[model samples]
Target: MTLLPVDEALERILDGVKALPGEMVPIEEADGRVLAAPLSAMRTQPPFDASAMDGYAVRAADVETPRAVRLRVIGESAAGNRFHGAVGASEAVRIFTGAPVPEGADTILIQENADLLDDGSIEATSTVASGRHIRRAGLDFVEGDVVLEQGRRLGPAGVGLAAAAGHAMLSVTERPLVAIIATGDELVRPGEACGPDQIVASNGFAIGALAKSEGAQILDLGIVGDDSAEITAAVQRAAAAGAHVLVTLGGASVGARDLVRQALLDAGMSLDFWKIAMRPGKPLMFGRLEHRNSRNPDSTSRPDTTGTMRVLGLPGNPVSSLVCAHLFLRPLVARLGQRSHTPDLRAAVLASALRENDDRRDYIRASVASGPEGLIATPFSLQDSSMLTTLAAANALIVREPGAPAAEPGSRCRVLMLA
Candidate 1:
């Protein structure tokens, strides 16, 4: 059978996916969340003309000239305590930052530009222009103005802006829940005694973390050995938990023990594709499981369920699993969580010569560094799919198109940044 191209496989995975529904969350808990609705200001900022500095509020006409001018200090105006009286001619009001400017004041004389006299008056050392050091009403934002647009990710500044806009709670997209299952008999959980043929399971943790970084909640099903019944049981649990996406590690290839694909089919999943034409990870699988109605629990032998779940089966090789996650799983989670996703691809110069590629598009792990000209990428000599250390040492992947001719050093290439 012919292998599916990587681009086509990804397009199929995201063909009709839509963001999950929205939920109401407190503003304090809204950081890093996507806004579901446009957030408008509840009230105008600086409801009244306010002082922008700790100084004296006076009439601009009273001190228009730069020469010394004396004005009697009438009353004090501090934040939250406004001097309701107006500033008459030759009169000034002591004011602090954020204090409401007196009704008749048109400017502020900064303390540094003024001197306090023993006769309860202030001498203006500099000319006070109209509107100087005064914050007009609605300067920051007006009531009914949208402070944050829909589908915007709330960061530190966004959260603070929402609070200043008088929003105690905000509407944000719900986080997608992903269920992860690690399969294979030669795998054991970390910290446990491993048999001679068994290695510690790790894909679940890495995949789970990757999904989380894209805003998906995780449900780890732990390690399921090479039993068809156990694999089917784990699939049922994921459906029961209403996982938006179910990621399974191992048992995707056509080996004798590759039972994951068949087990999922038995559990009512419609296969989308089986294999991908990509190096390191080729036995990738994708499918969708429709939820069966609970009312007709006995209509089929499967467990009752609600909502559809996208299933992705990855190869067991550590490096393959991680690479495929960056290529596929990251976007799927971002799509569900209402966040924009784009690969961090960059252009770089090859530091050494490389051989020609085959039909499968290759993602060569490489170390990237800044050069005198630009970024220089050097592919590692060893490209084993199971070596996690090599993958860890790599900061980028040199992307080589299929069937490309051998290239010499200094060739321009595209790279996907991992750092």
Candidate 2:
């Protein structure tokens, strides 16, 4: 089969994809979730003209001149408590920060600019312009104003703004459920007894972490052997659980024991692509499975839904699995959640010489550091896809295009940051 370019393969996978349906969640739990609808302010911020500093509320005319003016402190206005009486001529109200400005008061004489007199009155020592220290009603937002637009990810500031806008609950996109299935006869769960030919499964956890970081909910289907029936059953289970995407860790290549691709096809998955022109992840596969309703007429089992679930078959090699996920799975999940996803790509100077590349695109793991000139990306001596240590130690991947010429030290290049 002709190898598909990485860009073409990604385009096929994301074609016609849309975000999942929205659901109502409490504001406390809405962080990191995308807004499904425009968030409007329910009430005006501050609701009224409020004091911005700890000072006395007085008419601007009362202290406009530099000369000291004597005014009686009629009442105190603390937050949540208001001085109902108006600040008439020569009358002042002791107001704290965030307190509502008293009626007929148009300015605030900060405490530093006032002096406590021997009598019950306070003397203004400086002039304050009208509306100098007052936060006008609706200063931040007014009622019916769209504070947060749809498709916005609710970060810390977004959540705070939503709460301040009087939203106890927000409408947010539902997190796509990404079900993972690890396939290999020689695979065992971590911490379990293993034979000489077997290795503990690690790809699922890594992929699951990456998926969660993209706001996807994970359902680990555990380990399945090379048996086609078991793999097909796992696919059915994923569909029954309403998973938005099914990620198969191993057994995707054309080896004799590689059965994941065929099993998914047997279970009604329509193949989109089977191989990608990329190093460390050439055997990657993508497909879509239409959910089927197989429930008995009177059975209590829920019928399979109508939506189609995406399928991603990744190589079993630890590094390959993670790299493919970073390239493919992250964007798919972000698209489904209606969140933004952008690769951290940067230009750098190569610190060492590199051999001419093959037809396949190469992702050379490298360490990046700030140099006197700019970013310097030094490729690790080892480029084997099976070396997890090298992948873990590296902070960036130097991207080399297909059929590119040899690169020498100090040459400019592009990289995708992994740190």
Candidate 3:
């Protein structure tokens, strides 16, 4: 089969994808969740004209003359408390920040600009203008005004805005549940003893973390030996658990022990694509499976019954699996969470000269640094798929188009920054 282009493969994988259903959650729990609908203000901010500073409230005309004006202090107003009586001529009311502006008062004379007398009166020392140091009603937001739009991720500021808008609860998209299965007879869990041919299983942990960072719930099925029956059972368990996306690590290539593909086919998976024309992750596979019984075994509370479960079969190589997750799985999770799915690519100058590329697209792990000319991306000398140290040290991925020509130092290039 011809290897699909990276762009085309991603397009196929994300076809017909839409955000999941939304659920109502308290504003405190809405942080980091995507808004499913527009959030409107329930009550006007400042409901009434209020004071913006600790001062005395008086008519502007009463304190406008060049000469100092004296006024009797009749009452006091503080936040959540208001003076009901109007301020008559030559009269003032002491007011604190956030206090409602009393009736007949048009300006605030800051306490520093006023001198208090022994007879319970204040002499204005400076000319004051009308409406100064007063927050008008609905100054921040009016009732029914849309404060947050649909599909926006709720950060700290967003949550605060919603709270200010009188929203105790917000509607947010449901978190995507991702099930992971690791396959390989030569694999064992971390901290376990291994033989000469055996290695510790790390892909499931890394992949689960990657999915979780994207706001997806993870269901790790642990390691399954390279057997068709065992692989089939794991796939069934994923379906039974109501996983939206199932990610399989290893056993995807066409090796003798590679039974993931055949097992998925036997378990009624519709293959979308098998391989892609990309470095580090060439044997990636995507498919969909229909679950006969749409019930969730993990939770007593039932979610919406979903007919099809998306499946991603990744290579056994550690770096390859992580790179593929960054390029593909993260976007899928974002889409399910109702967030934007576009890759964030930034332009940078190559720190060193690079060789010409082959037909496959390259995602070279590199160290990106800010330079006088902007960002400078320098690729590591060694890019072996099995090297985890290089992947760990990389802060960005330098993107090179297929069959591109060689470039000299300081050449312009595009990079995907890793968070």
Candidate 4:
């Protein structure tokens, strides 16, 4: 089969994808969650006209002139407490910030601009304007006003806004659950002893971390040997757990021991596409499986309801798997989380020369630095797919398109920044 282009591959993977069902969660637990629907203000903010400064509430006409005006301190008003009586001529009400403006008061005289006397009275030293230093009713937001739009990720400010809008709970998209399976006879878990030919499994942990960063719940299914039966069982377990996405580490290439594809096919998965035209991730595979629950055996009472589970078969090489995850899995999780799936690419200048590219696109690990011209992307000397240390030390991936010509230092390039 011809290698699929990167853009075509991504389009096919995300076609018709949408966020999962919504769930109601308390505002306290809504942080980092995406809003399933537009959130409207439940009640008006500052329902009543309130003071904005610590001072006395008086009629604007009483303190409009520059000359000092003395008025008797008739009463006081505080937050959540209001003075019932009106501010008569030559009378003022002592009010603090956030306190409701007493009836018949049109302005606030800041205490710094007022002089207190031995008697229960204050003399205003500055002219006051009408409606000054007062937060009007519905100043921030009014009831039924949309404060946050749908598909918005709730952050600190978003949560605070929801709280201020009188929402104790919010409707947010349910986080996607991802089930990860690693396949390889030569693989072993970390912290365990391994033979001379065996190595510790690391792709599952990296993939799980990537998924979790995108607000996805992870179910690591541990390691399975190169046996087809074990692979089929792992797939079944993922379906049983109702995972939205199943990420398989290794066993995707067309090698003798690569049994993931055949096992998935046996498990009733329809292959979408495989073998992309990208370096370090050419053997990437995507497919979908129809999951049916056999626990309910009654034909009439339990209808055969089938749900689709997405499958992503990643290469065995650690760097290749991680790079593929960044390109594909991250966007998939973001789509399920009700967020726009777009890579954060920035323009940068090449800090060193590079040779002509092959048919496959390359994601060169590089160190990105800010310079006088702009961002500078300096790729590492080694570009091997098996080098995990270089990948870890790099802060960005310099993108190089297929069939591109040789480029010199200071040439413009595009880079995908890694968080």
Candidate 5:
């Protein structure tokens, strides 16, 4: 009978979570890892002022006339080769791209825009602007500048930037070792036969896969039943194995056979708040567990690691569990990974009229397609909390607020993208 709004719950959960520890990882294996520490440039980019074109490096004044001016080609310069001699007033250096610009040469006349005269000299055919086509020393970045900040996810562009700034290894947040456990007596593994009330316990597998996608190390603990002792034993064993976070499915609500709440209490977790004002995921629990093997110090001088185990007790319904994971568990993992880049979730309006806005906030399954006016989100006709097929087909959520007015076709509505 208690429910908190979406944004408030997210903020509270984020405030309580701690970032994962940092570790040194090789650059070759660094894509998608969150940077734990800011990286400084080891050496400046472009190290020296280099030519930016395959042309003649000359003083701007020498190329003033396009047709009749004859300039002697003093020496040849290519990439990695520097012209030691300076260009005279009417002389130019043959330079290729990435070659160091010769002394006293302030411009590059592109070869396409100039004709090579008969005696290994060059004839200027266009007026050249000074300082054109030149990559100055440290043009991109200077040494010791902070190139990559902490909490950045290293994608391809980020990786390329890091490499350009002279980093071969990066210090990134250590991937938190998380253990996922699903519990239900009526649950059977996929590829197995099902009795009257048996489900495949497929949500756990899906969640584990999603966690792995976020670069978290997942330990799939398989399934446990409705037995309290078995569940409690599994919880303790997972904690003992140094798991930073333990996510469990089922037994979160006030059900009679529900054992997750009791098991979490036995493991010394101070339950925060449970349940939220959202459909398909109302029975969610967030809390921290005190170490089962730590000694108390009279409420003072506590160690950093003790009482720091994080746990999320999710609902048993597959759709609800996955939705709750998206709301709570994914952010928890991202925080631990020190990933500051929360995927940019943009909002869009519902394309059609919506009749009912229930008393609770709704994340309706929807598909989005491009319209002449941007993305148009269309809600799926069938939305059941137990229907995973509908969830699979959906790529977004029409975020309907509690007690919202009946919406018209072109109203400004918030949509949470899922794709």
Candidate 6:
């Protein structure tokens, strides 16, 4: 099989994925969830013009004429109260912070800036500025403003913003369920092991962790051996559980014992494509199983969501499986959650010499460090695809496009951050 180029493979996989299911989760549960619809302000912030300080509200012109304004203090207003009567030309009303400004007041003079003289009148010590310490209604936000756009991931600040806009609830995308199945005859569970051919089932754990990091709920199907029936049973189990994506390892390759590719097809799955051009994951296959739906008016028609189960066949090698999950599974999960699935590629300066890349693009494992200079990256000396130890030490991957020229130290490079 001809190898698929990295860019082409990425485009194919990404283009195939669309936004997944959506539901309304309460604000407490909405953190980190993607918004399904845009949220607008129900009411303007600071619903009324208010005093911003604990002081007297008066017109700026009144300060200049009075050594002592002995007007009657008609009434007092706090945050929840409004003065029923407006202040007369020679009258003043006591006010507190957050209180609505009276009809005739345009300025606020802080209590510390004024004094009460012997005659129970305010002495004019400080000159007042126009429009001083007054919070105008709708100053922070206006009604009908789209405060939060659809597809936005809600954080603490986002939740507070929505609440400030008077929204009691929000609609958000439902978390996708990614079912992980690690397949290898040599693989055993973490606790039990004896034979030399047996290896602990690490791929599923890794893939499930990856899925979780991408906001997908994980269902670990454990290890399936080389037997085709076992693989088939696992696939059915994943599908029956309503997994949005199914990831299987080991049997995806073209080895004589490789049974995943055939098992999924034998189980009535419609194949999309297999064998991308990416290194360490060239044997990857993607497809979906058929499910009938009688609820719709068109009984024979398969709804878009029915064909939504994304089956990813990853290489058996541990490092290969993890890389495939990072490059493909995580993004697939993000797309399902309507998140920005694009990898975060940061700018960096090449710390060491880099040779010309081969026909296949390279995702060189590297360690990242921060300093006064900027992000510094160091690629591991070994570039073997099968080594998981090297990948463990890496927090970044230096992307070297195919046919790229040799890069010297201090050259500008793009590094995909793994952390």
List per-prediction Cα lDDT, in the order shown: 0.90, 0.92, 0.92, 0.91, 0.82, 0.79
- Candidate 4 structure quality by residue, lDDT tens digits, 128-166: 899999999999999999999999998999999999999
Candidate 2's displacement at residue 54, Å, is 1.2
TM-score of 2: 0.95
* Candidate 6: pairs in clash: 4-277, 186-199
Reference-based TM-score, model 3? 0.94
Clashes of each: 0, 0, 0, 0, 0, 2
Model 3 CA lDDT for position 10: 87
Better of 2 and 3 by TM-score: 2
Over 286-380, each residue of candidate 3 has an lDDT whose tens digit, in order, gives: 99998744555545567557567899999999999999999999999999888876777999999898899998899999999999979999999
* lDDT, model 5: 0.82
- Give TM-scores for every candidate, taking all chains together and pairing residue i with residue i: 0.93, 0.95, 0.94, 0.93, 0.86, 0.83
Q: Provide the lDDT at 354 for model 6.
A: 97
lDDT of 1 at 126: 91
Put down candidate 2 lDDT per residue, 1-419, tens digits, no spaces. Answer: 67899999989989988998888889999988989999999999989999999999999898977545789999999999999889899999999999999999999999999888889798888989999899999999999999999999889999999999999999999888899999999999989999999998999999999999999889899999999999999998888777889999989988999999999999999999998999989999999998854532223554545788899999999998899999999999999999768999999999999999998989999999999999999999988888999999999999999998999999999999997
CA RMSD for every model?
3.8, 2.9, 1.9, 3.3, 4.7, 4.4
Ranking by TM-score: 2, 3, 1, 4, 5, 6
TM-score attained by model 5: 0.86
lDDT of 2: 0.92
Model 2 RMSD in Å is 2.9
Candidate 1 lDDT over residue span 95-171, tens digit each: 99999999889999999988888998988889978999999999999999998999898899999999999999999
Candidate scoring better on lDDT of 3 and 4? 3
Candidate 4's TM-score: 0.93
